[model samples]
Target: MSTVKKTVEVDVPVHTAYNQWTQFESFPKFMDGVEEVTQLDDRHNHWTTKIGGVQREFDTEIVDQLPDERITWRTVSGDTKQRGSVRFERVDDTHTRVELVMDVETSGPVEKVGDLIGSIDRRVKGDMERFKKYIEEHGTESGAWRGRIKPGDTSGPAL
Candidate 1:
């Protein structure tokens, strides 16, 4: 498994950052490999992504979520094996620090080389930076779903 961790500070409140994060369908605007994301429901999403010339689609389930704090997801069906979480922390009245942690595994020689050279790390950092610019520039989220997902709950408020 290859792990990547990245953090970025955005000139927005924690709620703003967290709200933007919940707009999964807008992820492609700032997420490097993401091609598209469709929120199937409050706790489910379908993702289309291209990485290293390979395109893949997957279904992800939100396992846990906390408003203005964090969101965790895992692939329930997909061409890839991965799971991750996004966390939001309040820095002040107008600043928030967002953190991402992902665990991914890739098979094949090309993927192995890329992982060894830390390409995934670079990708994550780049994504984080883009998110910072996007949120700071917009000053608000495109949309928001402030639903709550408890630790053992698999469903959230309708989106």
Candidate 2:
């Protein structure tokens, strides 16, 4: 497995950043290479992404989440294998630092080569940058899922 970490500071409050992030279905609007994200339920999702001209699909589950603090997830089924988390920190009332850490493994040649060449790192950095711009430019979240879920918890607050 290879690990990648990227951080971006957005000029938005922690809640604003965190709330925007919880709108999973909106990711593809700003996240490069992401084709779509379908929210199957409050705790499950389906993702479609393309890399190196190849398309892949995956199912992910939110393993844990804390409003305004963090969200963690792992792929439950698909062509992708990864576990990751996003953390939100209050830099100030008007600033928040968002960091992402992911450990990923691939079973395909394209992804393997990309991973070996540090493309994953760069891709993640780009994603964070785009997310920062999207949130900062919008000035408000499209929607929010403020529910909370702790580690090992499956069901979060009622949607």
Best by lDDT: 2
Q: Candidate 2, which segments miss by more than 4 Å at Cα?
A: 155-159
Give candidate 1's error at residue 28 in angstroms: 0.8
Query: Against the hidden true structure, what lDDT does model 2 obtain?
Result: 0.92
Clashes of each: 0, 0
TM-score: model 2 vs. ground truth: 0.96
Model 1, span 44-91: residue lDDT tens: 899999889988899999888889999998899976788999999999
C-alpha lDDT values of all predictions: 0.90, 0.92
Query: Candidate 2 clashing pairs?
Result: none
Model 2 / residue 131 / CA error / Å: 0.5
Give the Cα error of residue 73 in candidate 1, in Å: 0.7
Q: State in Å the error of residue 143, model 2.
A: 0.5
Cα shift from native, residue 24, model 1 (Å): 0.5
